[model samples]
Target: MIEPASITNVMRALADPTRRAVYERIASSDEITVVELTRGSGVTQGAISQHLKSLKQAGLVAERPEGRNVYYRAEPEGLTPLVDWMSHYGVFWRERFTNLRTLLKEIDP
Candidate 1:
């Protein structure tokens, strides 16, 4: 079963466009630092850090400290709650689509 709180947290964390973009960058890279994420992002380093903090809180990203730079990477398992919540509604949508297809076939023939 998916926990509502976790789903909410993941959704809330990704709801912001800027934050979502930040997450995407992290997900695409094997590991990246705040300076790398800030480059060409049009946001300040502090803003990126803030976004990273939210992602970390949501379990969306994990960080490793090496030397003076901290590398951030995507946590694929963190999306389980959100994925489960969406999958729960998959049956409903599939049934609806099947009904629509039947109706379309009847109308066409």
Candidate 2:
């Protein structure tokens, strides 16, 4: 079963446009620094940091410290619960369609 809290956290984290943008940026890259994320991002470095903090809390991003800089990267495992929950629907529909097809074949055969 999918925990409500996990779904809520993922949804809440992605609800903000800026936060979603930051998460996507991290997801697309191997790792990105605060300075690297700031370029053309329009938001201040502090704001980016704040957004990263929220992302980390939501388990969408993982942070690592290297000397003076902190790097953020996407944590795909964090999204597993959400994906697993949604995958159930795909299986359900596939089985439902197969049953329907079988019934039709019986009727026409």
Candidate 3:
């Protein structure tokens, strides 16, 4: 249960390259550990943890603890609002383009 204002927070949290990479990796996999996420990113485990903290605060990720290990996974639905917002703008652009096409056809005819 995340609020709409938190969507902006989530987007801001994802603006960082490392955070985005971590998020995408989590999105692709079912669950990922902190060490796993830091493996090829050249970022320290501590840094990844910090990013994860921000992501969690933004409601973009969730974590589970299991016997001294933490696993992270993406909350894909957290991005729904942003996606829906873009969809609305997409519809607006589509209508504008359709109108332009009709106007061009009329001018040529």
Measured by lDDT, the strongest candidate is 1
**Candidate 1 residue pairs that clash:** none
Evaluate model 1: give its TM-score.
0.88
**Estimated TM-score for each candidate:** 0.88, 0.80, 0.88
Candidate structures ordered by lDDT, highest first? 1, 2, 3
For model 1, what is the alpha-carbon lDDT of residue 99?
A: 100
Global Cα RMSD, each model: 1.9, 2.4, 2.4
What TM value does model 3 have? 0.88
Q: Arrange candidates by TM-score, descending.
A: 1, 3, 2
What does candidate 2's lDDT look like per residue over 1-109, in tens digits?
Answer: 7888888888788889999999999999999999999999999999999999888887889999999999999999888867887798889999999999999999996
The parts of candidate 2 lying over 4 Å away from their true place are: 92-109
Q: The CA-based lDDT of model 1 is what? A: 0.97
Backbone clashes counted, model 1 = 0
Q: Rate the local accuracy (lDDT) of all candidates.
A: 0.97, 0.91, 0.87
